[model samples]
Target: MLTSGRKGLEASARGTTVLLAALVLASCASGEPEAKIEHLCNVADASEEEALLRGILRADDYTTDINNRTSRVVEGLERNLRDIGPAKETLSTSMCAYKPTPRAGSDRARFEFGWVPRTSKDAEPLLSGGGRFDANGAFGESNYFQTRLFVRCDMPGDLAEPSKAAWLYARASYSFNIGRTDIDQAAKDRQTALAYLMARRVTDALGCENKPLEKPPVVKPAPTP
Candidate 1:
């Protein structure tokens, strides 16, 4: 009787061990997909940054010595936006032609950044009415294979009054050529990164109370042409 009772207890212990192992396996299986999704959405690396800068500089076929100037112009715009007060009215700057030379084609890259007071009756209505912004508070549009990204973040503070609210906005676009019906995923990713970079700078500078923008997803490489 004693040996039989001992055997029964041993069997029960084995069953409990097996049950615990199964539960652990189930937990891991459920968590695997989320881990993979996070890995896939990793932030842009050095290569993507380099690609965007080079692409912007060589956006058009007409070659000129405006590469340095283009870089400086972009940097200056960011600085100006960051140095200004959060409640300031709309302050915007754009770079249309990097060089003085006339271009044979309309293909070009443009970078724009600005901020608008949410109190403005005219601008507030247009921005608030648009339901197109995504979870990251950004919207993108593509035309003629050109990718454009717009990002906005409303300032957070005691300014509950509509008259006191303000928002920061950034836009970036690059057009390779005209008449293409399909958009390039890689280009879109780069522009999205650029826009987020600008938005982050301004938000940090102004000390906005909003959360950081979500990282752009990694896009598969476009097929070779």
Candidate 2:
């Protein structure tokens, strides 16, 4: 009887330890920190040369440079949104352009630029009802843009289609309807249109479609020093 009681007591102790461990694990899991998010859009088939050329073509009085313009717009939009959490993010572009000149000996040049997105690649996005949540605990909506432009330029031997450049620009702009329900629909519609227009304006000005070579998937900008 004494031995049996000891065994029973040991089993009870083991069970208590296991239960405590399980509760600790559950608490730790619940208190885990939120992860950052990575949002990306590609404007492929554009090279640095192509982007430079586009910038030259688009500049009217040399007042605003292409890189500055692109960065400004992107930063402005990003600021409009609230910070989701504390995490490093990258927002970049794969952009190219062509600039035309009337001067002899020099015809055109290409330029490119890129930036880190506000979201990080390793961000662990939050979920609601088993679905991924927006920056706010809401669903997000977005749109895309892709088109072509025609330009005359010499072809590099490595890439195909040296006679025409294909401009593929994709912008994924999203908005979450968290607080204001009354104007949610109208605001979303407006944001969508604005994103498309902004993308088109830059692409068209760059003359990205006028190149004779294909571009990579993402617009790569030279690392800022």
Candidate 3:
């Protein structure tokens, strides 16, 4: 009887050991799926933006430098607005220049990446919601890079009317065009990527609360009192 009992106990211990080993193996296999490069490329507006900017950076040494500076600025903006969500608009009574009506919601934050304006020796505003960068001027004469990125914010009461639609209106000189073939195809590829990324980023940035601003005061402000 003693011998039989000892044998049974030994078998039980061995079974327990096997079970534990299996559990360990299962745990080792259990981990978050690795991020897909394509998915990552598509996820953050920043990635798309960066890919586009990097194209210009990869264009030529000069363009690369400009892109690098722009990248830094975008990084800073992303950090600042990481938690801010979409803005809502309301109409104000002002008639001369319309104002956005205010609506409130949870902040919607996203990442963006792009080249700085081609004219900016350093960061400076080129438009109310944009900046200028000179990739060649900042980087060098190689002309490999040329592009910019702008992180746009849609504040409450912004885009109060159809006139406020987001659009890319380029006023190019007659000479201005997509680069000539003599330019590196690779660099041109980057430009294409940058354009797509910029488009995507802008579209993403246009998101706003559907609700219009609280009704604007119909009466004009009493003749500037």
TM-score of each: 0.41, 0.23, 0.23
Give the alpha-carbon lDDT of every model.
0.42, 0.30, 0.28
Candidate 2 TM-score, true structure as reference? 0.23
lDDT for each residue of candidate 2 in 20-69, tens digit (9 for 90 to 100): 77777876799954432121122222433224323323322111113344
Best by TM-score: 1
The global Cα lDDT (0 to 1) of model 3 is: 0.28
Please name the candidate that would achieve the greatest lDDT relative to the true structure: 1
RMSD of each: 20.8, 26.8, 22.5
Q: Residue-pair clashes per candidate, as listed? A: 0, 38, 34
Q: Please report how far candidate 1 places residue 217 from its true position, in Å.
A: 6.0
- Output the better candidate (1/3) by lDDT: 1
lDDT of 2 at 202: 46
Give the TM-score (vs. native) of candidate 1: 0.41
Off by over 4 Å in 2: 1-67, 70-178, 210-225
- Clash number for candidate 1: 0
Q: For residues 49-117, write the lDDT of model 1, one tens digit per residue.
A: 435544544422222222223344444544554454545544465533222123445445544555555
